[model samples]
Target: MRKPTSEKNQSEIAYEVLRQKLLNREFAPGARIRYGPLGDEIGMSATPVREAIGRLASEGLIELVPQLGAVVKRPTLRDTTELYEMREAIEPYAAAKASQLISARQLKSLQSTIDTMKKLHDAMTAGKKQGQDIAVRFDKSDLKFHQTIMNAVNNQRMLTVIGDFHLLTEIIGAARHSYSIEVLEMTIADHTAIFEGLTSRDPEMTRKAMTVHIQNSRELTLSRLQDECPQ
Candidate 1:
């Protein structure tokens, strides 16, 4: 497993692992998350497990079932729609504002971001990607790349709010089972396009790219949900 990003507490590591499992669809939606099994699988213990799951329950990623204990939350079509709608509204604006002030150094970081994703993509094909073990790091890189831009947008409140959106997307992405080789390739390509727009410092193009990317993401996400739990 990729080392958890936060190092302060076992509960924190447990949280990241559980969250990733949920996002990656390693555990299906509505799947019971036994405390012992979760902690044991993550090489942790019950204490951290409880702490972690407790936090997730409050975050709406997990639910407390009276009879079955905690299970992954089943995101409704409404929830998915609302989450993507939130992204649609804020991410594009962040992209546009961020483009205006993005530095050359930051742009270079974005390029590196693309390079790493390419490596992960290659690793997946070769069966060497380490799956969730390494994917979380890649996800963090993606998060930071965009976060760097949001920071530049000079909107602290927006940044804070969008961070929550990122968490929600991360959960959805992690739990999404329909994700596969080709879909990820397309996603990486979309990232490339967004980076290209970022590099050019074209606010209009950045906004456009961001909007299209988020919209496409919404479609793909819904498609994945259907594959996982056909109605």
Candidate 2:
């Protein structure tokens, strides 16, 4: 029997909300996701929320534990390494392609994200007390900036792959407590460079900027992992 269109829409809405929460690190890695409470908060029934969890589990973002139901997936050090490697290969190429193809509206959107990031950075630097809140917002904006560039390339496969990689990185980062004030500042600087390159519409310039940013991120992520799990 076919489900009602409204039911399907509710399921999708639940999925998107849950997915954003996971990607935004509102639910830390290994945190159990309870459908009932989530459904209540989102104004939906538990059934649709459960369906959403099932979808996330299939995407490797959520794990189905026997007794614990759905839990956010915890990424390993090797997972981090491989994810960065994949990003390094695909993102620079995507940025270069985007340089040639990105429309003015996309550029404007990218700039808007960067502007939001800068504001977050400023607030954090001013010693605002909500450090975690500020960090999560900054991460969300950072993801949006990269995603905007990916969208410009118009390659669905690469967009999907790279988007998941970014989300996984955020999960790992939240688990490790890896975002420091210095790191926030560095991200802003790197993104500013990438935005400038894109604005200039220079493929080589954009590609190089992206490569350098990814290398720096890889170095920081690996160093943090080593510090956390020294052998």
Q: By lDDT, who's the top model here?
A: 2
**Per-residue lDDT tens digits of candidate 1, residues 125-215?**
8887566655576677667767777877879899878876776777666665334677668768888888888888898888998898889
The TM-score of predicted model 1 comes to 0.74
Candidate achieving the largest TM-score: 2
Error of 2 at 112 (Å): 2.6
| Residue-level lDDT tens digits of model 2 in 1-231 | 996559788999999998788766789878999989999999989999999889888877899999999999877677778889999998999999999999999999998988898788788778773678887888889898999999999999999999988887887778665357788888888998998999999999999999999999888888887755323
> What's each prediction's TM-score?
0.74, 0.89
Stretches of candidate 2 above 4 Å error?
1-5, 227-231
Model 1: worst 10 consecutive residues (lDDT sum): 171-180
Q: Candidate 1's C-alpha lDDT?
A: 0.78
Which residue pairs of candidate 1 clash? 22-175, 23-173, 23-174, 23-175, 24-174, 24-175, 25-174, 25-175
Predicted structure 2, TM vs. truth: 0.89
Task: Tell me the deviation in Å of residue 118 in model 1.
Answer: 1.8
Regions more than 4 Å wrong, model 1 = 1-28, 34-54, 125-141
